[model samples]
Target: MHNGFMRVTALALGIAGALAMGNAHASGFQIRENSVKNLGRANSGTAVAKHDASVVSNNPAAMVNFDRSAVQVDMTDINLDASFTGGGTTAIGTPLSGGNGGDPGSATLVPAISAVFPLSGAFDKVTVGVSVDAPFGLKTEYDPQWVGRYNAIKSDVKTVDLNLSSAIAVTDRFSIGAGLILQRADVTLTNAIDYGTAICTASVPGNLGASVANCLNPAYPFRPQANDGNVEVSGKDTSLGWRIGLQWKPTDHLTIGASHRSEIDHNLTGKADFTAPSAVAAVLGPRVADQSINAPLTTPSVSTISVEYDFNDAFRLMADYQATDWHSLQSVKIFTGGGGVLGNEPFQWKDTSFYSLGGEWDLSPAWTLRAGIAKDESPTNDTYRTPRLPDKNRKIFSLGATWNVSDAISVDAAYMRINVDDPTINGATSSSGSHLTGTFKAHADLFGVAAQFKF
Candidate 1:
């Protein structure tokens, strides 16, 4: 084979080994932690509300609401509580052993920042802004010896985004905006494998090429010699995307806004590390060598419509409906440049929608309180639930307050609790002769704070 083809084949292992784990969370790994104010409103009005510069990330057109240069910084702390129950998680080789895969989720933090500046001279009607934050990620870990270890042990994926946007008001009541997005992504995943199950692929006597059913099959001669091995993969990639938004006000107390974000395509390059037990390595060492890998992924796109209405001077309400195009990850295929088939995972994910309603209370000249509720649906199905991500339909309840110390300095804080429905996983088939099954109970708490300064 040519040197270039060989190099690509070597890297293909990582993608085949870890892609499942990397793209298994939040209805296929989507995140919404851009603003503390939005969090307080269950992300409602993100496309129209202009509480701070953070609006630049969701709806640049809303930046026209600001008259001066401003900077906003926000941070959110997440605490996840998740665990698996049920049975039939036994691996192929190891006797049915280990405990429930403790907490499958991790406590993590997400941060976001944005700055907006008004135009001058001839550009007086235009506003420009920049935003930085993470858009997608999940971190889940399990005991190395857990019953589901053969399926997943640790899975992590993260993405960072930088956006530059500009907006112009075409009329007193209408505005248009667009932004260019630059994003970087990284992933790592680990899992155990059954050596005996892998041997079924060998062209030897008593081998079952396509119907290998672990050591339980009487057709196998050395089922007792089965041993467990491990595979680890890590990779990174960068991609570009775009977003556009519009804002309109037909009445004094009501504003209508909409935004759409394009999807980013990523081609990641990385390496896979295989650690085989002595018995298995003696014969399969060459096939299990560390190799360079490539994984192709397309992040989801989103379209959101928001409405902000003021009942009177002291109360304002905002509602939103957002649709996510999770169909981008409909299925996944992994293979080497040399025509070697590593694995193919069938996702058949469905598109999902989120609905939110929030109300803001203006208590005093400097104090404002906010509250909201949201319903977030999951795209995953029971037939394909995996240990890497036990996602399900969820509800979010939130509360928040803003304290304006002065006209130029204000701080916002919000709290949210997420409740997830308990979902059951009907057995899911893995490579060779492995199948994994279980049920998951998951929930989380989020706390966010943001500081805004108008210059």
Candidate 2:
């Protein structure tokens, strides 16, 4: 009775899904487009740089730098270009191998809004701010009839964050900030099923060897019917995390800041939606129905420290370091509400680090030019690379400018390009018969614009 009751209670979290794909913006799904100023600087100096209200996304302590109320609105357009080339391609158990998967990459638009205000009286040393942005997301879809259909059709994951933060100046040279973060996450992963392989494994276990091979090729008379249907797992969840930071300014020309953001554990609740041929459905039974699935995912935490130095106000140099605790995301495990195992994706991701250096040069009283470069370590290795997220080491180059319309109004525009080290997808997945071997070349272009209004 106790065991049955425990099973019932776990089901209350609902059934959901899990998805993984590469993010060109930052390590893992970390999106750093909160401000065009920071993006132009390759996301460096976010913890210490002062430009707009969007600084709340970095270190809340930076908010104290703004004496007047300011509102910042930003928009970023991303152009994704990725393609796979087949080389020694083969699916161990299925006869599905063809040309390149036809560029699964997709274009995306990310937006952010934030505001900061000062308080009077005893709260003169305090500044309050709020920010809303989509911090993580990307999507990739391949042709339904592609060679890797059984591996991936559509894989996407997205997260939106709402942060409310406040900063207080303890003294002239020191300040602190903290925030409450509320985030929502959604996941969708889809793939095709080889009908012949399922049936042979079920009915004719004795003669399964020759059946799958023959049925996979249409030219063979023993071939099973083509188009056996597809499977899509979808899930959604909400979670809470926290952020804290401190800023220290030893000299008027030098600024330093450190910040730590907590990880969010999400129990996504959704169901498995399957559509298979009649015979295949009968064999799979409840597995293909609206059965409950529960996928637990822990987004990684990050620690960042940044430094900015002003050289006579006309030229500024900035550097920063970021460490992501990706070790927590060791795997994507899914289960039924009744404690039945559904899927286990061994991500085995490792903690990674990022380093950046940049400088901003004042062209005139009204315009400033910014350029930066950064290098990111990959959390994943070649051993676990999959079609879902063929992540690898990358390098970034950025350039932008800030146009001050007046003292109270300014516009920031920037562009960045990312180059992903050519990576090979050669691994097995949760499915027994799924083995994918190929190479992917992926790159991205980012353009952003932000307007700041001070009151």
Candidate 3:
């Protein structure tokens, strides 16, 4: 009984480790679809653009540029296609039997809203704003019996952020702003469990007197790939963070802006459920039963610097650079009810950077045209890459246009195409004794529209 309990404990730890592999539309699972106007230019000048109420989320300090109350609503559709071609896969020194998983990526819709209101009377120099957006989210589902099923079958994670901010124009040329961030995160992960390998690899004798020799016997009912179990883990958490921004207009044609958002930490508490073969369940007993679990996850912080240059009334140029503190996510630690450490999954992710250059041209009195290009770096390398997130460096191209329906209302539409560098997984091993080797072809497309109202 003691040995069986230990084996189950190890399996539970492995299940918890899966929580660390959430995919994202942006680098490192971060989402950048908060503003359609910005997306039109590949997010260039996001921190300095004061064209709409989205400034409330991009750079609160830019709110000072708004002379009246305004509201903006945006919707973005992201379509991702990722497929894996298996080079080879094995479990416990035996070749795994299964075909490559079909396309796991799916389409997702992201929405954002923001409002800014300027103060009256003595507070004339102050402006307040609010924004609601999904800062992170992604989902991937693979065929149940795929070659890499042991690594991951399904991964879904989502996060929402609410920001309340205020900006003060200290002087005509300088402005400062700060905001409070309320964020919520939810996750669900699933994977196959090799019950046969678990029993044979047991360091101590199993309750059923099962051993390596028994597993190797042709007549044995339970052996690698013969009897498979499944486990699913789900959790949710809410946390708080903060951000600050600065904007300076040194000259009439040039504006510079910078912002920093702090990291948010979450202590996710949830349940782990398992479905084991009848025979395996009988041997493991309560160890295979459902139990409460906890995991620690910290979203990374981000810093951005942007500049917008207005050469003349008809044309403007913009550039932006951003850095993500992905190193903060070095590892994910899982714990049981009594603060007992289950295991730690190491990611060793490095920090990443993003760069973009864009420009806008006034085509006519009622229309404007925009175009841009950008490059994003991936945080993971070949050693740590997994099928759940198979991220890689990517390039972005975007085109957009805005129609000025009237002085008080305007509509912005943008489209983006992302080209991802094919990533190769070279024998990445999992704690469950499964080694997956493959290559992935991936790409994404985004379409967005926004309406802005000023009152």
Superposition TM-score, candidate 3 onto the true structure: 0.94
Task: Name the lDDT of candidate 2.
Answer: 0.75
Instruction: Put down candidate 3 lDDT per residue, 1-455, tens digits, no spaces.
Output: 22222222222222223322233357878888998888889999998887778778778999999998999999998888777887444445778777778877767788999999999899999999999998776777888988988777887777889999999999999999999999988877777777777766553334457667766788877677777888777778899999999999999999999999998888887877888899888767776787777887888889999999999999999999999998877777767676766445666789999999999999997999999999999887888776766788989999999999998899999999888888787776654567888888888889999999999
Candidate 1 Cα misplacement greater than 4 A, ranges: 1-26, 89-95, 200-226, 337-339
Backbone collision count in every prediction?
6, 4, 0
Query: For model 3, where is the 10-residue window of minimal lDDT?
Result: 5-14
Ranking by lDDT: 3, 2, 1
Taken over the whole model, the C-alpha lDDT of each candidate is 0.73, 0.75, 0.79
Clashing pairs in 3: none
Task: State model 3's lDDT.
Answer: 0.79
TM-score of 1: 0.90
Q: How many angstroms is residue 22 displaced in model 2 relative to the true structure, after the best TM-score fit?
A: 5.9
Per-candidate Cα RMSD to the true structure, in Å, reads 4.5, 4.9, 2.8
Candidate 1: residue 215 Cα off by (Å): 3.5
Could you tell me how far off, in angstroms, the CA of residue 74 lies in candidate 2 after the best superposition? 1.1
> Which lDDT tens digits does candidate 2 get at residues 316-419?
99998999988876767778767886766666789999999999999999999999999988787888766666778889999989999999999999999999
In model 3, the runs with Cα more than 4 Å from the true position are 1-24, 203-209
What does candidate 1's lDDT look like per residue over 1-455, in tens digits?
01111121212222222322222223446778888998888888888886768778788888888889999999988777877775553334334456887876666788999999989899988999999988787666788877767667877777899999999988889999999999998888777665555564344333435333535666654342256777776678988999999999999999999999998888766766777777556655476677766667778889989999999998999999989987877655554535454555566678999999999999997999999999988877887665555577888899999999999999999998888888776775444245556677777888999999998
TM-score of 2: 0.91
